[model samples]
Target: MSLLHRIEHPRDALAWEGDMPTLGRYTAGIAGEKFFRAIQEHGQFLGTVCPICEIVYVPPRLYCEQCFEHLDEWIEISPIGWVHTFTLVHLDLDGNPLPEPLPLAFIQLDGADGGLVHFLDEIDPEQIFVGMPVEAVFKDPAERKGSILDIAYFRPV
Candidate 1:
């Protein structure tokens, strides 16, 4: 069957519409798989080092973006990181006002070049600030599912 509809005039092409309801599955490529697996099983964070760039990638990648070199030097990095920036969320997913503000932050992982944007718990919203040190809280090993969610959230350390 032909997928394209014949269009004789430019204006006819403007009204085309189709429903492409997609159901898809995605795998975290090699590097991400390795990274999450470690987080799930060991409660440790892993990063791949790029010697040429003198950088470490957390939630590691298979190749370096700058030089396109394959990254193989894996290192265990501290799960503790400092908040690079943060926000207070006063509304829930359903748009209801929360009883208390939720703190979330972009945490720059210590000793690695990348970071994770995750929830910040166990701290007052007024006290959460840039550069506040925090650490991850992981689910019990038996409960982990090899995803970023394995780390329940980051909390003040």
Candidate 2:
């Protein structure tokens, strides 16, 4: 089967409801706190790199999973990378199709060994490709909050 075929859209009102008691509130970790602060204060992108293993983790980290050691160093990551995978989201979980479609892609960030999943904007679905280059788009400095939304989306570079 194709990768697109494996993708499923939520088709019921229950899926869109946010009233579930099990839903958790947003809490910041030590590393994540630093990350958000940087976005809000400096408009910079920082990631954690294991000094021992050299694995770069975006959104930063308190420890290296591979070497099993505490990490304190931060590395700046490039906003550009290739799209490893992507999909066109046609519906908003309520089963209703959106007035306009959006594309979300898993971008393998440059300089990091891995990637992050985020929305891709300002491009048509037919224009997206598996290895297309993309750059992060940051919100206006004044409008930025300490959240991932500070980086509005990735756009073709």
TM-scores of the candidates are 0.84, 0.82
| lDDT tens per residue, model 1, 16-115 | 7689999899998999999998998899999999999998998799999999999999999998999999998999999999998888889999999989
RMSD per model, one decimal: 7.4, 8.8
Global Cα lDDT for candidate 2: 0.86
- What TM-score should be assigned to candidate 1? 0.84
Q: Pairs clashing in candidate 1?
A: none
Best by the lDDT measure: 1
**Local distance difference test, per candidate?**
0.92, 0.86
What tens digits encode model 2's per-residue C-alpha lDDT throughout 1-157? 6776643556722365566568679777999999889888887778988878989888688889888889888887877888999999999989898987889999998988787899999888899999999998989999997988898999999
